[model samples]
Target: MYRYDNYDQTLVDERVTQFRDQMTRYLDGRLGEEEFRPLRLQNGLYIQKYAPMLRIAIPYGMLSSDQLRRLASIARRYDRGYGHFSTRQNLQLNWPAIETVPDILGELAEVQMHAIQTSGNCIRNTTSDQFAGIAADEVEDPRPWCELIRQWSTLHPEFAFLPRKFKIAVTGASSDRAAIQVHDIGLRLWRDDEGEVRVRVLAGGGLGRTPMIGDVVRDDLPWKHLLTYLEACVRVYNQFGRRDNKFKARIKILVKALGIEEFRRRVDAEWEHLKDGPQTLTPAAVEAAKTHFPEPERRPVSDEAIAAYEQQRQEDRALARFVTNNVTDHKVAGYKAVTLSLKRRELAPGDVTSDQMEAVADLAERFSFGEVRVTHEQNLVLSDVPVDQMVALWQALDELGMANPTVGTLNDIICCPGGDFCGLANAVSIPIAQALQERFEDLDFLYDLGPLDLNISGCMNACGHHHVGHIGILGVDKKGEEYYQVSLGGNSTDDASLGKILGPSFYREDVPDVIDKVLKVYVESRHADERFLDTYRRIGIKPFKERVYA
Candidate 1:
């Protein structure tokens, strides 16, 4: 976790004071709604369906236990006694009073957190893989690079008001857990033959009214010029990206119109002057960023401990399933990354109660070095749990209703707040997610299906990232009637691909049946040991579409 310094602390404290004054003016009628719109948006406040929603950024999805406790306290005092974790790894308080938002921000500031850059058409939070440094397959930690970009993009005068919101993701792992390919700017970090760090830059990828997998604009960019090259790309977009239409204003639209080659050429020309400038990263700066993320202390586990874990697994089926689905292999031996499921039945997909949040904070302190991580799929991660304590952690999580054994399964759905909270949504997404979860509550059946990503979005804004799910459900409004559209074969991985629509949209009540039909087709057609995604990729979408529409 990155700690705040004097400069960082002062910056946030000052912003809170500034926003408080601005809000007072708005409430006092000195400022109209139209006049206060941008100011409030930049502070991460949105006027939703019923009340004001406040989105707080969890940078790169990292949080300390103390910070979690503060968030829980804020939720208890300000809003309803719960918070919804978003698909971008941010948290949203849906019922915050407009007048008291400043107080909420002040509380967040005490924990070195704030809502700045969480909204508005500026560079949003830079995200990375939740597994980051501990993932067994990671080449290097991408958090430092994410942090560097965060500092550079925050309140940058040059990019303060882009045509549309910009999102950037970095991944150093062979697996693309960060969904880099679908971001406005995606950086893949790797070492060259001489062992020097480099980046593969992808541009123009997004999912809204139009969905696209980013094109590779720069195949091999030296790590030293990371900031310079990024600046060049943004500069090109800012200058040429559409300003006439909000729907067409994103960088993805610009990349499509100009083509990848021309986009690259323009960026390269801009980079000529910026390369090796003072903004270019030096060894000392990179080292300083790395120091912010020191590795957690570890102790060696004896062979007897491993044997005991294996013995416990054989005796307890639920524990075995929890380990199989919720636990991931860590880079360090005798340790695992455990994902806490927030998608319990009867609740919204990403909603966490205040008590649950406090419980997780305590568990993180006791089991995982007082740190927690939020994943893009709307789950939390205790990234450094020792294998020896796995059983106890599992029991604690189960007691808190966080151990669902459904990570990467059909029941672990990614969903947006939809019409329930967001005014932009045409249909409700949470109920659909809950219906599907209830329909697929059988653990044995889910395990048999194997590693399915079912994502739902209230509308085409794609906040749920439905475009990249194995099975995507998008809410559509046909003459004010709510309908759900289904897509298949989408994925967010090393070989990222956008999902294809199966057919026309279905009625709201019909969506669960439609999903069941799609899964049935997959289970019948799949070869031995094939996942839903693998089966879909192998057999194409025709089989599932035929069954779904039949």
Candidate 2:
């Protein structure tokens, strides 16, 4: 993880002091709610349905054990005892008092963390693959690039007040685990034939009231010009993106209105003067960034240990299922990336208690390398767990209720805090997610269904990224009554696609049954060895829609 230097520390401390003053003024009636709105939003504080919600950024989803402990402390002291990990890979404190947010930010600053840029119409957190450095399929580690972007975008005067929020994701792996296609800017890192690093930049990808898969605006861009090129793209959007309507203010809308070719042309024209400017990256700078993320030391595991793991898998069904679902192959032979699922039966998706956070911190120190990663799927990853210690880690996680063997299953849902916490939500999303989890509690049945993504959002904001789920559920309001809309065939991958609506919205009580019918149709219609996504694509949405609406 990147440690903050004096400059970084001073910046965060100054911002905390500034916000503290702003908050005091607001409370003292020197500033009104309207005046304080932007000030509080810039600090990642939101006035929610019942209380204030504070979103703390976990840059590139990286967290040290110390940071995790600090977060746990903040959750316990400032708000309720639990916090929600969001789709953006940030943590949200749902019950923080408005007056106490500055104190919370002060604590976060002590741990080199902050709530800066986690919300409002500015460049938000820069995210990347959870297994960025450890993934077997990675061509390069995207964290350095993510870090550079984070530094560049944080409080950038040019982009501080964009028409709408901007999100950027980077992926070094061939697999699009970071959902690059659905970000305002998606950087895909790859090497040229001559081994020079390059980026393929995608623009306009976003999910909201209008969902879109980004278009490649620039391909094979030299790594040195990454920042300058990004600046050009954002500049184009800032100048032309609509401000009259919040719905159409996003860069995605601008890209759509102008067409990819024209958008590219405009960005290219903008980049002409800025290509090799002060912000352009250099080899020395890249190397300096890389120094902060040195590779972890590799430890050899004997063949006997591997044999024991295989033997355990053969003997214990539960262990086998856990390995199959929660564990991923690491680039290193002896290590594995283990996902600590936050989704349990009764809890909302991505909700982790303070005690659980502390437990994970301890487990990270004991099993992994004192590091944890928050995934876009609302799970945590211990990216360097040794294979020899897998069984012990599994037991520890199980005891902590974090070892759910439902990763990539329907039960591993990605959901937003919905009407329960978010004032913008039209209906409650957590109950729907819980109901679906209960309806699909059978492990055998879930495994049979195979690799399904079920995501829910309380509204069209797509905070839950429901647009990209295999089964997307969006809460809707019809004549003051809450209803749910269902969509199928959506996926966030190399072949990203927005789901199509099945039909009119269904009542809240009908959602679980509707999903069951859809799955039944899929199971009956799928060919041998076909995954849920493949089956849906092969047969089209008609079969599922017919059964769901029947």
Off by over 4 Å in 1: none
lDDT, model 1: 0.93
Local lDDT at 81 for model 2: 90
Residue-level error in angstroms, candidate 1, position 321: 0.3
Candidate 2 clash figure, as a count = 0
Clashing pairs in 1: none
Tens digits of per-residue lDDT for model 1, 406-498: 999999999999999899998999999999988989989999999999999999999998999999999999999999999998898888889
Which prediction has the highest lDDT against the true structure?
A: 2
RMSD of each: 0.9, 0.8
Task: Report every candidate's CA lDDT.
Answer: 0.93, 0.93
Query: What tens-digit string does per-residue lDDT give for candidate 2 at 418-488?
Result: 99889999999999998988889999999999999999999999898899999999999888989999998
Off by over 4 Å in 2: none
TM-scores for every predicted model: 0.99, 0.99
Judge candidate 2 against the unseen true structure and give its global Cα lDDT, from 0 to 1.
0.93
